[model samples]
Target: MGLSDSEILMPASGADAVRAFGDGRDVTVFAGGTILMPMIAYRRYPQRARTLMLGRAGLNQISADGNVAVGAMTTLAAIAGSGVEPLAAAARDVADPEIRAQATLGGNLCAPPSRQGPRGDLQAALLAARAEVRCAVAGRERIEPIDEFLAGLDAEPRLVLGVELERPRRAAYSSQRRPHAHSYAVMAVACAELADGVRVAAAGVAKRAVRLRSVERALADGAAAEQASAGALDGLEPQDDALASSWYRREVLPVLVRRAITQLGGG
Candidate 1:
């Protein structure tokens, strides 16, 4: 069917949104409309006949009580403006102000990346912070760790409700750009304090965001940030894209990783 034959649904609550998404037909959940709208208008999304818009489902909330809970509909502009650690810094580097205003956390996580590479700056920071993804399907809700969620990206549930991260003692994020007018990141790194020790994560360099377990272990064993970062890339594979080559990404990974650790007080 053509776009004109589509049915746009506006759900009033989370449950209603979940129900709409599980209606047994091709349904796309629309949040922020930053990615989906363009795809539909340009005929990129052929199955746009059923779309569930959750803009008014009361999911655009961010709370910081002990742990942080950010609704999926919360805009990147709001997150960047808050000055909240790692994530805030990551959000600041996203696109322009207009794009940020229409980009939501859930949409950013689930949307496919552009040719530049993985659009997972926030995912890296969240992984280091040990965040959780809250999702709902047919009103049945569940929370999964960020690692597990990323591991199962091929089978994500119907709707993303929110994301939760524990309060960290310290956190930092860093990314490299091509110095172009509005270039996306060539590579990005994030570090955060966890109960066990410091955790590290990276994006852009890989097809998917990933945790740097070797770096984290080396740092925990008292290795210098540079040394740990170097060791972390031993068996890793980085991607090559229009903005950067695999070799360039590999060379810059340690530098960005070192910077993130340094910003977190030599972690």
Candidate 2:
């Protein structure tokens, strides 16, 4: 399948994008297009689908005060250079300079197929940082926690406007991948400070990137970092593929968790 007659609509503003999505027939929102281009070429997505592109949509801005706000079209490269700690660290590991320059946070969040496998790396890092997604559909705006938003990706009609997060006091992200910047990690862990205590999230170890609440509980109870990490993979079913076997992922998950926790000043 190829994009022979695929309709491409370039919206001039965010409001226009929302309007275009509302008329949806199999709409795929194109931001940076790094993720979508491959899906189109591989016939993973319908070849004749509608594509709502975020061009000149005023969604590429990044601003910060006490809280940080990143527009949906903001490039991964910009985020990597934004001095945002763990998020920046994770973005830096996404790919080489070129892909990063063309990848958007919104695309990454929504690109992953809604099934079992390694999803987006930023999802876990954002989860640990307690980020919120701001979105809209047909003039109706919605604001929700990042985790909840991710869980309902298929059902949500809202297009992501931006993400919001408070600046973290301490944060870190780690992943098991080849030294090559473009390689997909078998597992990734992120740790950060929260108002209540420390929070931890991991990617590539389950159907989707998720928080390790069991590990967070262990840390809150003052357990040793090694002990907390050792027990963290209790319920996760890490997948196996060409990059790594399932057992290898399970074995390395705890180590990544420990290192991330240590980096966050928790252990």
Candidate 3:
């Protein structure tokens, strides 16, 4: 079941891509290979029957006519320069320039947690932006809220096609990292003020980035930034990893949340 023995399927269009993905039984969808290649070299990657290379699937589009829509195949480098606020900043914070240019949005969304730490740096920002993920699952396409998509990620295998979201009136992002290209963030927070209300999310505190619903509710209840940030630990169960200890993540999450919220003028 090594890669050498696997069938490599490269689809030239989105339709054919999802059709190839079908039920995702023994398929590994390869995007930028930023996360996969390392595991591959270290011999830690799982063996699959097929590797679906999505390089030419015609999904690398970025649209901003009104509501923002970004194809899953779009590179982080493209997003960093797309003027998309917290997303742009989060994209810029990923790895070094070369990695950013090669790594992709879909790969980030679908990255499983590694032994070292959590992998999806863009999740918090996208969650706070109220992004919707458009993915092909079980032979059909569906769009769901970011949180819902993440909730079922471990239970299902889906092929991400793109993400769409309405721009927030104000947004901000904050993170603490070791100042290295390969270093994952110790903790990160993103906040946005949308037409409906405020949204907040955090990363590096769980298996995946999560929406800070308690914090958002507190904010809606007229709590100050500091008060709302106190709810950062509502449902999160932080775990110790190579980058930071559980206690450290618990202590600093509120600080990052407060900083991001305050930047959005939520104070």
Candidate 4:
């Protein structure tokens, strides 16, 4: 839906934007409005855009501790162009070229429907990399788990400050889409730097994006990527979409997981 109405609240910085969400007005935080504008244009939202955009400060800064700090409003183009290896590669694969140029990483993470499913691109990528989406609520607070927060999107009016993709160590994201980033049939991310060795997670196949912790453990123990059996699709419920069949998704997941892990330098 388009904005629910109100005034424009563009804070001086990202931190300032976090504070505004506390005001309790009907404020829907905006970054690039890539998702917001398109929905509105197509009449998905009934009201006009609201005031109060939480600028770069809330989720825009890239921290030096190795994690990429993206402001809630940081456009997808920014993250895609950040030159931050893993994240950059993922961005390069986002839908079509035009969408990537205008969409914000914040918008992609915050809007799940637009992202296709919980197991889609950004969520699965961050989940595997152990990323944290810093958010602000009630009384000057900060939250990290974007997954937990996203689960309850239907229930609250919370604001997304920005997502912090923690320290990167050889990582890669892969997905099954129709030749572009329009959406994903199956999306996977494999990383070797989070804890010890590599971990894999798949989105676009089920709810909450399925993490192959089991496969990760196997890899840590030195199993080759090809050794990642169908077990990699464990704990998932693939869905049928206009793009592909559920069966097709189930069949392709293991391969993608292997490719991601292997390419990231994992066995």
Candidate 5:
């Protein structure tokens, strides 16, 4: 189906956007259109009742005062230079400059797993940072941790407003990817030293990014980076895809985790 067949709503403000996205039923939210445009061109996108365009929704600001706040519509290009550590690095590593300029943070966070491989490269960094997601759901605004948000993504329909988080004392990111920046990573890891302790997360090991709880426990118990990273595969099953086999992802994940943790001064 073509976009011309769908009812499109372009809201000028966040409030209007929320109202237009009521319950998200049969609605496809169009952000930067980095991913959706291709689907549309190839006729792979399903026909939805409505297309809610967020380009002018007044949701593209970044705040870095006492705490950090990023609007859902902020582009990866803007975030690549935001000095947000692993997030900026991950954003810079997304696609080429043109794709990054057109991809929005909200789209990245809500990206589903693709047949080729996992696609949300920024997810690991945001997971490690322990960001909070602000979304409009069920006719109300809700704030939840990133982990919780991801866990419930398939169960509910919502409009992502933005994300908020505190600055980390130290952060590091590591990944194994094809030479082409556009290709998704085989495995990626991100770590951050927060006031409470350290958090670690990885992507490409599953359908979505996941926290390395076993590794975090080992770190809290004073295990060396190498030793702590040995637990990277606990409670997780890697999948085979075009990029690499499950075994290869399993083998390399620990290495990436160790490298990120060591880089974060946890060695």
Candidate 6:
């Protein structure tokens, strides 16, 4: 079957913009155009983006101190070159350099789920930083926990502003890519001094990026790297792709987790 499409709505401010989300509305929100543009060209998207909201009513606004509140249309390049969390650096790890220049954090989160390594980077880093996602729907604006916010979301028609990753005591993210420049085969983020002893999240391993609770519990019991990782990811079956196998992810995940935890003074 083929597809048909209609109009584009341009929003000029944040308040009027975030309220545009609704159910049963076949609309595509445009940000850096990294994900949406290419998909449209290839005719892969099921819904037609009718309203091209062309304003930053809700996309642009960094807090006076350091908190960032970006409208759904913020771009990755903008974040990469800024003083935001090092996730931007992780995002820099994304392939298609041109795409990075046009990718937006809001787009990355709200867009369809991707298996690419960068998606993990954004989610994990944000989780580490205790990020918050602000969403507007049903004529009401509300903020949701970053981790909980993204959970169970299937990218329905909703207006998502850029994220806010609060400053952390220590946080780091690393990715292992196949050819070095291609998307990461496995990505890890370790956060310490966070409410939990250590929160480790990895992407590109399974259907959704996961936080290593076993590893966290081990560290809580004052375990060292060897014990922490050995128990944290002991028997999980990671998915295998062209770039890696479940065995490979299991092997490297612990090492990276150890390093991240160690750096945060967890070990």
Every model: Cα RMSD to truth = 1.8, 2.0, 1.1, 3.2, 1.1, 3.0
156-246 per-residue lDDT for model 1 (tens digits):
5447889998877888998997775256778888888977789899988677788899899899999887788876586688877887889
lDDT of 2: 0.82
- lDDT, candidate 6, 1-267, per-residue tens: 243445656666665565554542666666666666667797765566565453455475555265555545556666666655546655666666677766667767765445432354466666666677877665567688876776746654456765665555566666666675555446565453554455666666656566777877887888987778676565467777655777887788777777777766667
Model 4 agreement with the true structure over 242-263: per-residue lDDT tens digits: 6667788788888787778778
> Can you tell me which runs of candidate 1 are displaced by over 4 Å?
23-25, 46-48
Ranking by lDDT: 3, 5, 2, 1, 4, 6
Pairs clashing within candidate 3 = none
Q: How far off is residue 213 in model 6, in Å?
A: 1.3
Count steric clashes of candidate 1.
Answer: 0
| lDDT on C-alpha atoms for all candidate structures | 0.81, 0.82, 0.91, 0.64, 0.91, 0.62
Winner on TM-score between 1 and 4 is 1
Q: Please provide, for model 3 over 1-267, each residue's C-alpha lDDT reduced to its tens digit, 9 standing for 90 to 100.
A: 566998999999999999999999889899999998988999987679999999999899999878899999999999999998789989988989999999999999999988988989899999999999999987899999999999999899999999999987889999999878789877889988889999998989989898899999999999999999999999888999989999999999999989888888877
lDDT of 5 by residue, 125-204 (tens): 99999999999986699999999999999899889999999988889999998998789878899998889999999999
* TM-score, cand. 3 vs. native: 0.97
User: Which should have the higher lDDT, number 3 or number 4?
Assistant: 3
Summing lDDT over every window of 10 consecutive residues in candidate 1, give the lowest-scoring window.
112-121
> TM-score of each candidate?
0.93, 0.93, 0.97, 0.83, 0.97, 0.83
Model 2: per-residue lDDT, tens digit, 137-224? Answer: 6667788999899888767556899999988888989888867766776788998886778889998877678899999999999988
User: Poorest 10 consecutive residues of model 4 by lDDT?
Assistant: 112-121
